[model samples]
Every structure is written in structure tokens, then in C-alpha cells.
Target chain A: MKITILYFARIKEVVNYSSEDVVLPEEVETIIALKSWLSGRGATWQKLFDGSGVVRAAINHELVDDMATFDEGDEVAFFPPVTGG
Target chain B: MYLKVSVQPGDFDVGAELQQLRAATPQAGALVNFVGLVRDVSTDGQVSEMVIEHYPGMTEKALQQIAQQAMQRWPLLGIRLIHRVGSLTAQAQIVLVAATSLHRQAAFEACAFMMDYLKTEAPFWKKEVGDFGQHWVEARASDEQAKQQWKLPK
Candidate 1:
């Protein structure tokens, strides 16, 4: 399946890309699985997807947990915890 | 009920906003507003500049959800929430949350609740430029705690 992934804030700085379109393997279904598949890219990906950071995810403009499922054209965004008011 | 939520880079006029909000509903006998500003001092040093960024579509959605929650909890006639993004200087207005009600207590509580939820639930981030250099502002545990206090009674 194909999806558009977006990175924001510090995550975007670390990933060095704001957004990208990627084709996921069949095994990758949920956001957690997608993160695991992307984590295999390299060291930076490992650091982010390691679950150590306070990263949050949103599927198609609404906040969702890692268990959230996505379709082929879904938009997924990853970023650090909010600090705004 | 009237609810306005916007995420923009430009500054806002609080006086005008208040006047408009009050005029929108004559039955509203109480109006309360809270404006958040960028402070100059930071933990490391003085913050010379600040930058705010947000997920555009998601930001408005989050704010609307917050206002909706406030409306459900309080007897509010209207809500006005505006948060600014992009580069900002010290003492600049960062956010505004206002609530109108038939009485003072509901307006006050709803306004505070709106702000507390905005700090934690909204998908906006801040970067501070200080003597220690630029750094993304970390989410404060206190903020999460404050938002949690608004849980509806069972």
C-alpha cells in the first residue's frame, strides 16, 4: 500500500525530510507496524522509532494511537508532543 | 452558539475581538478571555526570539474539539480561540481563548478550560531562541496534569 507520511518539529529535523510518499510492505498495516518498517531504514530512523521519544501520530488530520489502521491514500503525521497555548 | 477558531501568523486585536464577541450575543452577561504571551526569560537564558509551528488542518480540528467540549460542559453562548504561528518576538501574543456566558463562573471556567486543553491537546510546537541556542520547547507535565483535571464527573 502507498501512503503519504509527514514529519514535523524536531522529528522533521531529525528525519531531514518534511514529507514523503512510501510504498509499505503487506505486513505493515497499523501505524506501529509502519513505524517498525520505517525504523529499519537507518540509524536516525532507529532513534525516532525506538519508542523512547514522546512522539505522537495523527492519521488523516486527527490524532490517533499507534494501533490506528490506515488505507492506501491515508495521510499519516508524526511529531513530538505538543507545547503550545 | 458561536465558536471561532483560527491558526494564523498575524497578530490579533483583543479589544476588537472582545467587543465583537460581546456584541454577537446580547444575552451574554459575562465575558472572559485569556491571552498567552511569549516571555523573554527562559531556563537557559533570555529568549530573544520564538517560532511556533503547527499542523494546519489538524490544529483547527483540535481547537474546535476543545471548544466543543467547553460548550458541552458550560452554559456558554460563544467561544473565540485564536493561536498565532511563525516567528514571534518576546511579549508577543501567542494565543487567545475567550468564552461568553450568562454568568461569570461559567465564562471563567470555560475560558480556563479552553486554555488548558489548548496547551496540551493542540498539535502546535514552539522553538525558543536563547543564549543556549535554538531548542524545541518540551511538553510540561504540569500542563498535562492541568488538562486532566477537566475530566467530566462520572
Candidate 2:
């Protein structure tokens, strides 16, 4: 499956890229699984995704948990906790 | 009910917004509005500026949902919610939430409820620039606790 991943706030700074499009591995189905797959890329990815609760995910614009599933062409966003009023 | 939600980079006029809300719902006996400003001080030092970023498409949807919830919970006749993005200086207006109702209680409660939810649920993030350099603002536990009061029984 192919997906567009978005990084926001501090995560964007750490990731050094605002957004990207990539084809996912067959084994990556859930948000957690996707994070683990990305984390395997390098030290920066591991620091951001390997730790639990350090980041939050949203599928197609709505906030979701790690267990949330995504399909092809989904827009997945990862960011820190919101601090807006 | 009359509802207006805007996520923009430009500042809004409070008087003009209130006038429009009043004109839209002439029968409303109460109008309550809240304006949030960028604080000049932070834990690190004096805050020189604040940069706000948001998920564009999701932000509008989230604000609308919060306004709808306020309408459902209270007898609101109209609601106006505006949040400004981009770089802002201290004392600049950042947000405006206003509600009109038949009574003051309903207006007051709905306005407060909307703000509480917006604080925690909205996708916008704030970064403060100060003497200690720039840093992303952290979400407060109190904001999460504040929203618990309005939870409806399933």
C-alpha cells in the first residue's frame, strides 16, 4: 500500500522533512506497525518512534491510537501533543 | 443555529464579530465572548513571539465539531469561533469564541465548554521564542482535566 506521511511541530524539525509519500511493506498494517517500520531506518527515526507515547498519530485528519488501521492512499500524520487554545 | 468558524492568519475585530452575532440572532438575550491573547512571559523568560501551526483541513473540521457540541449541550442561538495562525507577538489576539443564548447561564457555560475542548482537542501547536531560544509549548494536564467536566453519559 502507498501512503502520504506528514510530520508536524517538533517532529517535523526532527524528521527534517515535512511530508513524504512511500509504499508500505505488507506487514505494516497498524499505526504502531508503521512506526516500527520507519524506526528501523536510522537513529533519528528510532528516537522519534521507538519510544511509546512520544508521538501521536492521525489517520486522514482525525486523531487515532496506535492500533488504528490504514489502507492504501491514506494520509497519516504524526506529531506531538497539541497545545492550542 | 447560526455558526461561524474561521482559521486564519489575520487578526479579527471583536466588536465587529459581536455586532454580526447580535444581528444574526436578535432574540438572544445574552452574548458571551472570550478572547485569548499571546502571553508575554514563559517559564524560560520573556516571550518575544509565538508561532502557531495547525493542520489546515483538520482544524476547520475540529472547530466546527466543537461548536456543534456546544450547540447541542446548551440553548445557543449563535456561535463564532476564530483562531489565528502564523507568527504573533505578545498581547496580540490569538482566538475568539463567542456564543449567544436566551440566558446568560447557557451562553457562559457553552463558551467555557468550547474553549476547554478547543484547548486540548484542536490540532494547532504553539512554539514560543524567548531568551532561552525557541521551544514548542507543552500540552498541560490541566487542559485534559478541564474537558472531563463536560463529558456526557453514554
Candidate 3:
């Protein structure tokens, strides 16, 4: 399945890229599954998804927890929890 | 309920907003105003400007949800939530939440409560401009703790 991923706040700065479109394997069930799939790709992806990483997720523009599900044509965002008032 | 999320500039008359709300209804006995300023000191003392980024649609929706929550919680006569995005200087008013209610308690509590939620719940991103370079500040555990009070938040 193909989905567009958005990066924001600190995660955007660390990744050095704001957004991208990627194809994931069918085994990618939930957001946690997607994280594991991405990590195996390389060090850059792996380093960003470590257990201690502070990444928040959203599916299709709605704020969601890590367990959010996804499918083809989904718009998933990975961002740091907002600290601004 | 009124909401304004802009990237243009942070020059608005909050005082006038307060007065207008107060004069609009006789039931309003209290008006509460809060101004969130951009500071040079981050947790790491990152001294400089801040570049704020936001999801145009989602940001508005989240603020609107908060405003609706405020209305549901109290008898607010007027509510204004103004947030300025983009690059901002030190001490600039990044956010303003003005709420008016018939009772002083509800006005102050709801205004303060909305800010507490905004600090963690809003879809805002801030990049610190520093002596070395600009970078996004890390999300902190303290912010999470502060949001715990609103644990039952929808």
C-alpha cells in the first residue's frame, strides 16, 4: 500500500524532510507494525523509531495514537506532541 | 466562539476584544484574557526567534473543539482564541484566549483550562532560532504531566 507521511516539529527537523510518499508491505497492520517495517529499511529510519523516540501519529489529518490503522492512499503524519500554547 | 489562526503578524487589540465582550451582554460579569508569549529561553536556553508551523485545517479544528468544550463547560457570553503562526520574535503574543462569563469563576477557569490543553493538544510546531542554528525543541515529559489533569478530555 502507498501512503503519504508527514513530518512536523522536532521530528521534521531531525528527519530533514517534511513529507514523503512510500509503499509498505501488506504485513504492515497498524502504526506500530508500520514503524517496525520502516526501521528495518535502514539506520536513518531505525534510529527515528527507537522505543524512546517521541513520535506522535495521525491518520488522514485526525490526531491519533500509535495504534491507528492505515491502508492505501492514507495520509499519516509523524510529529512531536505540540508544546506551543 | 471565535477563532483566528494566522501567520501574518501579532498586532491586535486584545483590550478592545475584552471591552467589546463585556459591553455586548449584561449577563457577563467577568472577562478573562491570556496572552502566550514567545520567549528566547527554551529548556536549553536557545536564544532567538521561533518559527511556528501548523496544520491549517487540523489546527483550526482542534481549537474549535476546545472552544466548543469551553462553551459546554460554562455559560460563556463570548470567546476569542487568536493564535499567530510563522516566524515570531521574543515576547510576542503567540496566543490569546479571552473568555467572558456571567460568573467570574467560570470565566477564569475555562480560559486557564483551555490554555493548559492548548500547550499540549494544539497542532503547533516551533523551531528555535539560536546562536548556532535553528532547531525544533524536543517535546518534554513535563508537558505530558501537565496534560494529565485533562486526562478525560475528549
Candidate 4:
């Protein structure tokens, strides 16, 4: 399935990219699976998804847990916890 | 109910926003407003400026959801939530949240509820630039605890 991924705040600074569209492998169906798959990209990805820090995810503009599943054309976002008032 | 949610890079006029809300909901007897300003001091050192970043589409959606939840939780007649992005200097206004209701209690509680939810749930992040250098502001555990207090009893 093809999906769009967005990085915000410090995550964007670390990844050096704001957004990307990619076709997900069959094994990457859930948010945790996607995180694990992306961590294979490089050191920065590993550092982010290695569970050292709290990273929040949202699917289609709604915050979700790691077990939440997304489908094709969905918009997924990853960022550190929010600090806005 | 009247609801306005905006995510912009420019500053907002709090007085004008409040006037508009009051005009729209003439029946409301209480109008509560909260303005958040960028502090000049931080834990590291004197802060010069803050750079705020937010997810374009999601920020507005999350704010609207928060406002809607506030409306449901209280008898609110109108709500206005505006958050500014981009680089902002110390003492500049960063956010405005206003709630109007027929009574003071509902308006006061709703205003605080919306702010608590916005702090933890909104996608905006702040990067503080000070004498110590730039660093992303960490989310406060106190904010999470404040939001949790609003949870309905199971």
C-alpha cells in the first residue's frame, strides 16, 4: 500500500525531510511495524525509532497507538510530544 | 455554537477576536480569554526567540477537535482558538483561547479545558533559541496530568 509519511519538529530536523510517499512492504502493516522497517534505513532512523525517546504518531490527523493499522493513501505523522498551548 | 480555529504565522488581535465572539453570541453572559506569550527566560538561559513548527493540516484539525470537545463538555456559546507559528520574539503573543458561555463557571472551565488539551494534543512544537543555543522544548509531565484530570469517570 502506498502511504504518505510526515515528520515534524525535531523528528524533521533529525530526518532532514518533512514528508515522503512510499509503498509499504507487506510486513509493515501496523505503526510499530512501520517504525521498525523505517529504522532499517540508517543511523538516524535507528536513533529515532529505537525506543529511546517518546515518539507520537497520528493517522489521518487523528492520534493513534502503535497497534493502530492504516491502509492505502493514509497520511501518517511522527513527532515528539507536543508543547504548544 | 460559534467556533473559530486558526493556525497562522502572523500575530492575532485578541481584543478584536473577543469583540467578534461577543457580538456573535450576544446571549452569552461570560467571556473568558487566555493569551500565551513567549517568555524571555528559559531553564538554559535568557531566551531571544522561539521558532514554532506545526503540521499544516493536522494542527488545525487537532485544535478543532479540542474546541469541539470543550463545547461538548460545557455549555459554551462560542470558542476561538488561534496559535501562531514561525519565528517569534520574546514577549510576543503565541496563542489565544477564548470561551463564551451563559455562565462564568462553564466559560472558565471550558477555557482551561481547551488549553490543557491543546498543549498536549496539538502538533505544534517550540524550539527555543537562547544564550545556551537552540533546543526543542520538552513536553511537561504536568501538562499530561492536567489533561488527565478532565477525563470522565468510567
Candidate 5:
């Protein structure tokens, strides 16, 4: 399955990218699995999903928990905790 | 109930916005608005400029949901929420939330409710550029505490 991932604010700065489209493996079924897969890519990616940052996730524009599942073509975003007024 | 929610990079004219709402909803006896501004200083002194970023699609949706929640909770005739994103200078307006109702209490409470929700629910981040350097504004635990008060009783 292919999905679009979005990064925002400090996460974008740290990742050095804003958005990307990637094909998910069968093992990457849940958001937690997806994070684990991304973390396996390297150190920088690991730091993002690792317990280090206050990362939050949303699927299809609605905020969700780590265990949330996404379907093919879904848009998933990873961002720092909101600070807007 | 009437609701207007906007998330844009451009500035909004609060007076014009409020005037238009009032013109359209004459039955409303009370009007309340809250405007958030970029401050000149943070914990680190003397801020230069601030950059506000948001998830383009989700920002509007979150504001709409918050405005709808306010309408559901109060007898509001109308509600308008505008949040600005992108580069902003110190003292520039960042957001405006306005509510109208037949009575003062409803309007006041709804406006406050919407703002409190927006602080935590809205998908926006702020980076303050100061003499020390730029840093993303940290989310306040107090903001979460404020929004928690509105959670439906379990």
C-alpha cells in the first residue's frame, strides 16, 4: 500500500523534508508499526519516532493514537504538539 | 446557527469581520471576540519575528469542529474563528475568535471555549526568532489543562 506522509514544524526541520510518498510493507499495518519501520531506516529517522520528541500523529486530517490504522492512499501526518492559539 | 472559520496566511480585519457578523445577525444581543498576538518577548528576551505553520487541510477542519462544538454548547447566534499562519512580526495579530449570542454569558463563554480548544486542538506551530536564535514554541501543559475542562462528563 502506498501512503503520503507529512512532517511539520520542528519535525520537518529535523527530518529535513516536509512530505513524501512511500509504499508500505505488509508488516507496517498500524501507526506504531509504521513508526518502527521508519525508525529502522537510520539514526535521524529513529530519533523522530523514538521516545525523544513529543511527536503526534494524524490520519486523514484527524488526530489519532499510535495504534491507529491507515488504509492505502491515506494521508498521515507527524507533527510536534500544537502550540497555536 | 451561523459559523465562519478561516485559516489563512493573510491578515484579517477584526472590525470588518465583526461588523459583517453583526449586520447579518441582528438578533444577537452580545458579541465577544478574542485576538491573539505575537509577543515581543518569550522566556528568552527580545523576540524578532515569529513564523506560524499549520497543516493546511487539517487546520480549517479543526477550527470548524471547535466552532461547531461552541455552537452546540451555547446558544450562539453566530461564531467566527480566523487563524493566521506563516511569517508574522511581533505585535501582529495571529488569531481572532468571535461569538454572538442573545445574551452576554453565552457569547462570552463560547468565545472563550473556542479559544481554549483552539490552543490545543488546532494543528499549528510557532517558531520565535530572537537574538538567541529561533526555537519552536513549546506546547504548554496549562493549555491542555484548560481544554480538559470542556470534556464531556464521563
Candidate 6:
């Protein structure tokens, strides 16, 4: 399945792209799986996807927990936890 | 109910907004206001400037939902929420929430509740531009805990 990932804050700086398309492995079903898959991309990807990282995930525009599942073409945004008032 | 969410490279008058709300609702005997300001520190380093970004359609909807929640929980006679996005200098206001009711406790509680929700739940994001370049401030555990205090039935 294909998904678009969004980057914000330091995550955006490390990723160097606001959003992108990627083909997911069959094992990548939930947001946790998706992050795990992203972590395997390389060192830079791993830094932002590390489980302890402050990244927040959203399935489409609705914020989702790491266990939330994703469908094809789902919009996933990853960023530092929001700090706006 | 009055809401204004915009991305302007400018400032606003909270006093004026309060006056407008007061004039618009004669029955309101109390006004609760929350003013958000830009600070001068970032986790990265000393912050000199901050830039705010937001999802246009989504931000307004999220804010209105907060106001609606306050109305449902309290006897608010009027509600006004305004949030500004874009480059902001230190000490500049970012958002304001004013809730008016027949009693001070209702107005104050609802206003505080709405602000707490916005700090953690809203879609707006701010990038702190400091000596070390820019980085978005991570969500604070304190905020989540503060919000949780209100979760019990009241």
C-alpha cells in the first residue's frame, strides 16, 4: 500500500521534505508498524522514528495513536508534539 | 458565539475584543479571558523569533469545537476566541479566549478549560527561530497533565 508522510518541526528539518509518498511493506499495518518501517530506512529516518522520539502521528488529518491502522493513500503526519497555544 | 482565526503578520487588541463582547451581550455579568504570548526561549537555544503555522479550515473548526464544549459545560452567555498565526515577536499575543457568564466561576473555569485544550489539542504549530536555527517546541507533559485534571465529570 502507498502512504504519504508529513513532517513538521525538527522532524521536517531532518527529513528535508514536508510530505512524500512511499510503498509500505506488507507487515506495515498499524502506525507502530509504519514507524518501524520508517526506522529501517536509514540513520536519519531512524532518529525521527525512534520510539522515544517526540514525534506525533496522524492518520489523515485526525491525530492517531501508534496502534492506529492505516489504509492505502492514507495521509500520515509526523512531527514533534504540538506546542502552539 | 464569535470566532476569528487568521494568519496575519500583525497584532490585535484584546481590550477591544472584550469591549465588543461586552457590548454584544448585555446579560453577561462576567468575562473570562486568556491571552497567549510568545516567549523567548526554545529547547534548541535562546529564541529570538517565532513563526506560527496552521491548517486554515481545520484550525477554526477545532477552536469552535472547544468553545462549544465550554458552552455545553457552563452557562456561558457569550464566547469569543481569536488566534493569530504567522511570524511573531517575543511577547506578542498568539491567541485569546473570552467566556462570559452570569457568575465569575463559570466564566473563569470555561475560559481556562478552553485555553488548556487549545494549548495541546489545536492544529497550530510554532517554530522557534533561535541561535541554533529553528525547531518546533515539543509538547509538554505539564500541559497534558493540566488538561487531564479536567477530565473527570464536573
User: For each model, chain A TM-score?
Assistant: 0.96, 0.95, 0.87, 0.97, 0.96, 0.91
Task: For residues B1-154, write the lDDT of model 4, one tens digit per residue.
Answer: 9999999989999889999999999999999999999999999999999999988888999999999999888999999999999999999999999999999999999989999999999999999999999999999999999999999999
Error of 2 at B126 (Å): 0.5
How do the residues B10-33 of candidate 6 rate in per-residue lDDT, one tens digit apiece?
777889989988887788889889
List where candidate 2 sits over 4 angstroms from the true fold: none
- Which residue segments of model 1 deviate by more than 4 Å? none
Cα error, residue B148 of model 4, in Å, equals 0.4
Q: Each candidate's fnat, in order?
A: 0.84, 0.76, 0.71, 0.84, 0.88, 0.65
- DockQ of all predictions against the true structure, Cα-based: 0.88, 0.85, 0.65, 0.89, 0.91, 0.54
- Judging by DockQ, tell me the better candidate of 1 and 2: 1
**Poorest 10 consecutive residues of model 3 chain A by lDDT?**
A51-60
Give the Å error, residue B69, model 4: 0.6
- Candidate 4, superposed: residue stretches over 4 Å from native: none
Candidate 5 positional error at B37, Å: 0.6
Classify candidate 4 by CAPRI docking class. Answer: high
lDDT of each: 0.92, 0.94, 0.78, 0.94, 0.91, 0.79
* DockQ, structure candidate 2: 0.85
Q: What is the TM-score of chain B in candidate 3?
A: 0.85
Q: Which stretches of candidate 3 lie over 4 Å from their true place?
A: B1-10, B23-26, B43-46, B152-154
Q: Which stretch of 10 consecutive residues in model 2 chain A shows the poorest summed lDDT?
A: A47-56
Put down candidate 1 lDDT per residue, A1-85, tens digits, no spaces.
9999999999999999999999988889898998888889998998998978877999999889999999989999999999998
For candidate 3, the TM-score of chain A alone versus the native chain A is 0.87
Among these predictions, the greatest lDDT belongs to 4
Report the C-alpha displacement of residue A14, candidate 4, in angstroms: 1.2
Evaluate candidate 6 by giving its C-alpha RMSD to the native, one decimal. 2.7
Note each model's CA RMSD in angstroms. 0.9, 1.1, 2.6, 0.9, 0.9, 2.7
**Clash count (model 2, backbone only):** 0
Lowest lDDT sum, 10 consecutive residues, model 4 chain A, at A22-31
